[model samples]
Target: MPTTDNQGSFLNLISIRRNQVTAMDNDQELEDLELFQKNVADLFSGFLASAEEPSSAKSGVETIDSPVTARDNYIPPPPLLSISWFRNLLDAFLCCEAEFKAVLVSGRDPSQFTRPPLDRLIPDLLERSIKALDVCNAVTHGVELVRHWQKLAQIAVTALQQNPIGEGQVRRARKALTALLASTVFDVKENSNGNVHGKSAERSWSFGRRGGGGGATMNNKDPNGRNLSSFSWSVAKSWSSAKQIQAMSANLAAPRGGESTGLALPVYIISTILVFVMWALVAAIPCQERTGLATHLPLPKQLAWAQPLVSLQEKIGEEWKKKEKKGNAGLLEEVHRMEKLAQSLVEFADSFVFPMEEEKATAVAAQVKELAEICEKMEEGLGPLQQQVREVFHRIVRSRAEVLDVLDPVTKLPTPVPY
Candidate 1:
């Protein structure tokens, strides 16, 4: 086509893309029509394809999205693949970004979405939002994701009269997911198997060394080869599944009569195999388990401080009512969720997986229950008239932090502080 015609066509395409983004604003429309996502892949593909098109002056074909311009081609972030059997979470990312974008287009700030969207997209949105936020959340300084989540929550509630994705649950989980994603570091290549116990790696000098470094051997004893537990073939295979695993070398392929084969014939051949196997397993255990705390544990430990928070919550509620007699509903609900989440934070910090665990878990669960209640209030309390309620929530969290010293993880006791 002519130069002017090419320019016009490109502008038309850009307009089409922008319109697609705009159309996605309504969650119901986006989900029902599947416009944004379907268009997203194609639009991005076109944008990438356009990069290959040379300048018209150089050849014949012209660009579409115009790679020469300083704009990203739009590769959506992939999801967390914390498993041996899974591939990239691009599916998860696409799903989540659509949800995030849908909420943002719906007019709420992306960070301020408080719940999953309605219009039958709640479950899918919740799953994607969690991971999509993880991309934004994968770093601490990036608080922008929080705004996105807050907006998501808002769109979800406004769009659905009755949502299958519980308003309170999504809010709490979103908050926790955001926190974990932001706080923890993500390691991509780490394995996900075995209990950790110190193990040594089998390295070699290979200077025509006395014994060859062993070849790759499967360690059934260790998922990560801690050798802390005995290896079973099924266990070893399961743990090392879908990963770049290590091998062990035991025997020498060299000539027994060779002059170079000097040194200690004093050792039993079988003993070397046993020694290498045991030690190798020990070295690999912890390394395999280090995908980061966020990957291993989802969100915060389910709240364990619910019961204690109930009475305390009532008191906080009364106190909030007294201090902030007037209100902004949205602010109030935000405050309430914050308070309960904060309480859950304390309880979760105190929890442990073993020994004296039941009590701590129970306490934490109670806190979660309170958090759930607060989430409900926050959802109901959203609007322009609940600002005071929000403040009350702040005060409650602050006061609770003071009342209960930080929970100690090891001892499972409240920290001793001057009270």
Candidate 2:
């Protein structure tokens, strides 16, 4: 009933409106993705800021006098790997991971993931996340190791806190400190030697039947003469943290060309974040065989988040190098403090006099107070941190499952069993 020209005109108008609507939707999606990326960057930026702040454990602050100007531009020294910092890191991951899952769900078309780039990218991200689960398990075990050290240190604390500070008390404290130091050194040596399930794992940093608590001299026995290694390892003995990290970071590079836009970009962003978080965890927390573990953060400078992440990675890397130089076990601030304070206490007890002098008694009390403070912090923080790690583990598993549910049937890719 209508002329061909009129029909064409009407269809053209409809097509134009449809295109306008599509353009608006695409723009909105892009904006949302960018905002997500910015939020993640901000979270890590906060972490970097906290890392640069002065440690709360310090008793006094030293100010520097500059003749040039009096602007008071003394920046704080970077903090060590702390429980609070690690918890915040985990919290950031959970938030970013949730937002990432939302982005994937927002795509509206399940078939989009089956398309080029995303089809490969999505599966790779999921697989990397699966590998992270084992690392989480290993980190949880590391937390247990720290807890064991805390308990042994507490024994020394209890003994040293005696009111009279007698010879007997000194002897008891020295014995506990000796055991504690030996266990920590043994753990580090084992990790360095790449022997994960050696006596270190068996005792979880406890003194074995050996009199001096030396790992080499100790038999296959716990301090309490029970098998504690059964409770030590959550992952397989052969699971090396460094190797697992390398596997996750393998082929992880910045998305380019067409892959740098739309969903693929966000996928790549999340992947980088995933690797960085796991790398940081491995660096800060003691895991099985973390020798030669390297940081794997590909800083794509074009993205707003990459700069801060790269900065944090470099700072962490520097800290790792410093720790390695000192033959330290991990970058955990409390652990470092504990090791120093415990060693000093052991030296003090070893050189103790029969009638403890007043100055010496005061020094011992101060060290005991500091040790107790660290113990208190560990008591409050480690349990929650271990629980948070478990939550992270379960979340990764759940996310991988959700993604596999969406992609497996459509892409016909092999579904990996949840780790």
Candidate 3:
């Protein structure tokens, strides 16, 4: 058995080798990914040329500027891979990505540039690049450590996978399998053989939605019961799908009251019919009797003008039904449309929850409070006690003509009401 230091050093060398292999693999022109993967293995598995100086034989001609300098200076230091440090780097890496995503969200047209930069483009993706490098370093060290653990995890997975595997061994295998899969270094393999040390299953957990594809993660909680996000999201694997989804989301949730969308024709019809029938009935009744009507009612003179309102209302009603038929063809489509509508509301709620700007939300909350108060007042009718108002006025002035007759009744009074 190797000492921990020896294992750690070996793992570090492996990581350096892996990075070189990866760089070369990335340069592959072949369309076949398998060949690319083979290149990756070949790049690392072969013995790397040593840069250490060979002792010159007596009187041997020495070449100046050899590979020694290139090797020692360019190779990065071993990454910190302690459990605590790894976890911290993970946190920082993710936060940087989150901030980047937030900045990318234009809250307007993502493609159409607005003020400042005028686009979803952030000013300092350099920082993201830095974060990315940091993450890479963290990951590199993590992979080195993983190789060390793989030696153990493989043995565990193999023992458990054997025929008539012991129940205890199976549980151990699963526990080990989950740990291995969850590790950032090993979790993203295209091949399953590496998913577990020796287990054949290639399955892995997907995490975080990005560009478009999404993934899930295990839930963990603290002692205080405060929920912390340990999981990451990945967008759809298809780039086109991801881009489309992002665009669709951005447009649908446009900051300036989203553009009108296509609704199912039948949905429009039902919505139209409901509104028309309900409001037409309300229209026939006196404004005073209808809810929220009094405050919005036009003056008596405006009522005459509103004679067309009834016709207009009918026209609007007909248009709505027509529009519904045009947009959504049937009940099924309408229903699905409603489902998406419901999802939009959920998305809307999510908007308010995260990256919450207190100033904006507080202002909105204040406006909502005022509106709610006005609604309550309307419901209670505290300001519209017309019958009681008349009674009170009469008691105060049994005969305004009699009282005002002595006190300059002609003070431009429009003569009192005649009995």
Estimate every model's Cα lDDT from 0 to 1.
0.28, 0.73, 0.29
TM-score of 1: 0.17
TM-score, one value per model: 0.17, 0.82, 0.17
What is the Å distance of residue 262 in model 2 from its true position? 1.6
Steric clash count of candidate 1: 62
Per-residue lDDT of 1-419 in model 1, one digit per residue for the tens?
79999999999999999988876644454353344334433433432333333445223344575475433443322111111101111232233334333333334332222221222122222222222211111111111222323343343333222223243544454455344333222222221121111222322211111123531122335456464211111122122211211211122221134211211110111112212211211221122221211101111112221122223223323433443212111112233354345545534433323333566546545555554544454344222112221222233233323222221122322222211
Which structure among the candidates has the greatest TM-score? 2
Error of 1 at 346 (Å): 5.5
Instruction: Name the TM-score of candidate 3.
Output: 0.17
lDDT of 3 by residue, 102-213 (tens): 3222132332222222112121211122222222221222223334334334444354334443445545544553453343233222212112332233223232222334
The TM-score, computed over Cα atoms with residue i paired to residue i, of candidate 2 is 0.82
Sorted by TM-score (best first), the order is 2, 3, 1
Candidate 2 lDDT over residue span 236-323, tens digit each: 4465778888988886878778667688878888888888888888887777677778854556767778878888888888877777
